[model samples]
Target: MAEALANPELRPRLEAFDSYPDATPPPLAATEELTIPGPHGPVPVRIYWPGGTPSEPRQGLVWLHGGAFRFGDLDMQEADWTARNLADRAGAVVVSVDYRLAVEGVTYPIPLDDVVASMHWARQNTADLGISSISLGGASAGANLAAGAALRLRDEDDWKPEHLILVYPSMHVDLPEPSKSLQLALTEMLPAMRLPPEMFHSMRENYLGALISNPPAYAMPGLADLDGLPPTLVLNAEYDDLRASGEAFSASLAAAGVDVEQVLVRGVLHGFLNLSTSFEPVDDAVNRIAGRLRAAGQNP
Candidate 1:
């Protein structure tokens, strides 16, 4: 763990966000900008279709951006790049959603409502989008939305996604029992990563609103009944706090007879996917997701 932290390449890029330098955005073919009406207000979405082969029907992916549910938008450079990469790599149309943040909206059901609306919108426009099947996925808080969306879709709408992908998702508000190695890793990495404990508590409080009496399984996927969720791929950083949540979610899925794949990427931290230069694990995880999509598309 010490050696991993001491790696110069990893050290600098991890701290890059502190200074927040701007870099060139990845080139995408074309983006259709539009607003989908939600209960709260207009929810913005950017639809990205890869350049080439418009003749064939494609797979669709509804991408939720991550910012701990407090600070992300569809227009961010990282989100745009992720959409473009997923579209190009998976040969799928990507609809990136700009859902209401918890800080602004302050509620339990609001974010989940937006996610469900986004999914419905994507499904309704499948003909125009030229896709037969759809998947839901995201990184961090986005993955939280994906998990919640899947549950809501199954229970409320009786619809199932073709696939679900979670990248270092925060599925539980509670921390897991710490193993010795995990403890060591967290001790070294948490301080270095500069994740404030108070900030997380604030985010959770904002998302839960006043309805904190009972922990809803919808808010925490690990607590939910995982009987009918789609086949899932859960990716986690070995040193991330969310690692336990991902593992627990995977175990729940397996116990409920759901097909599940969980991958732990070593020597990576939370939000690594956003750091393109420093995070080689993101590329590998994306490739795996694309392969899974291809197989699902072929079989479905």
Candidate 2:
């Protein structure tokens, strides 16, 4: 992203996520851009509704996009496509959240706060929003935020999400082994899949100052308490360095006796979720998520 910003030719295309990229899988019946008040400012959100008569009381989802807490937007191709597809597949109203990014050296808790606030806002207006059951889905950095919010909600005696949908979540900021890092660094040369081990260090710094200070475990889900959380569905990519951590997190959740299911997609790397066109695995992952949400029912 830094390099993209440096080159004048690519800056606009990189910054403007709305008209940036294209991916066609399924079309949404309706799309809406709306906002809710936040501690920082008005948080922008995009809503997707499936085609057909709305269900008696719509099932809803609160989605967070992944950009390492600094790279994504509501209009980004992956975010938009996932929202639309989930709306169509799950028969639920999907709300894609555009929370405050931790750019310019912003500290921890802000992004999580924004997400939790958005959930509160949505829940408060559930009747107005025409939704009964609510679930949470997020990818990469968004997954981190979703899990953190789930923890917060559980601790506060707030309404827990019916389920958690996480895709390639960056759960731990720890450095990988030299060989693993080398493999990740080499894989970036592959077409369309981008995951650099070094970037994780920088992202951790950018999001939460220095690791020496040791921020709360919520900043990194792998270090947090996993008990009393919502049922979680964690999806990981085979070649992703973060896969190890995500899998460990899942195991921890299971050990804690929390309901958890994890799927490891072979022959793919981090950011695989965004390569639906180039990769066939994306559809299977999406379908699995939708099916899980559908089975979660209107109230669970």
Candidate 3:
């Protein structure tokens, strides 16, 4: 993949970023592929049930993958591998949602609606699935969707996630600018990591369509009132433009009196979650997510 980029010298680092030391996914007790009813149609999902017998109601996680709202699938490492890892470590049922991407006639609410529906389905079936609770989480654009759905669930239905996990998310339509030190470091180290505002504007426009002129708060979650939301974990990549948004959103969550933990991973670019578990930060982030989910289930 790096061969196609302007900097061929980056091939080694980029390859390492993409490859896991062990390509095989961690073992799971079981995995089921099925469809959940959605407003638009059926939303496909993969459920990763952890290995071993449960002593109590296991935790559940409703997860989504990032692709700028137009790309990605349940098969991506961020969705499948992460779900498997989380399930194994947290001993939780990880529901990886194949929510509708924003493409062609599909737009903002359509994709977000799919996620909300999936969450409702997961929560309603917790007992049948032998899980006590479920949390909502995602990476990048998927994180944007997760946050938007969290607000919708809170306002529209007075429902809230047990926990929220956001990884390298770009939450705002108007993103916060990177600090001078960050900008300098990115330019000096990985200039390709710099994302122009126009790119983000275009990504939002592509996702929002006609709603681009006046997107609702749920459509651009950073614009929403974040009060009454559940505890959250925000992981931002060290060298990504979207780190600004993650940092800003973390601050917003804290100001809203939400329990929020923000971690800025060093020496990495965005979407590192898609990389192999051999990457120390990626492994650590997944472990942290697992530990939190496990604790939430136990406490609840």
Question: Which candidate wins on lDDT?
Answer: 3
Off by over 4 Å in 1: 1-27, 179-181, 194-196, 277-279
- Expressed as tens digits, the lDDT of each residue in 63-171 for candidate 1 is 8888988888886644777787778887888999998888855687888788899998998989998898999998888898899999999999999889998988888
- State each model's C-alpha RMSD to the native: 3.1, 6.2, 2.4
Please identify model 2 stretches exceeding 4 Å from their true place.
1-25, 175-197, 210-212, 298-300
**How many clashes in each structure?**
0, 0, 0
| Candidate 1 clashing pairs, residues 3+ apart or interchain | none
Estimate the TM-score of every prediction: 0.89, 0.84, 0.93
Inter-residue clash pairs, candidate 3: none
lDDT of 2 by residue, 1-300 (tens): 666568675454334321322435576677888889988888888888777887387788999989888988977766887887788888888889999898886668889989988888888877877787788979989999999898888888556888998898877778434346436543543322345557767788888876436868878877888888888899987666677677777888999888899997755556765664334566688888888788775433
Predicted model with the maximum TM-score: 3
Q: How far is 52's C-alpha from truth in model 2 (Å)? A: 0.9
| C-alpha positional error of residue 156 in candidate 1 after TM-score superposition, expressed in Å | 1.4
Ranking by lDDT: 3, 1, 2
Tell me how far candidate 2 lies from the true structure as C-alpha RMSD in angstroms: 6.2
For residues 34-118, what per-residue lDDT tens digits would candidate 3 score against the true structure?
Answer: 9999999999999999999988889889999999999999988888889999999999999999999888788989999999999
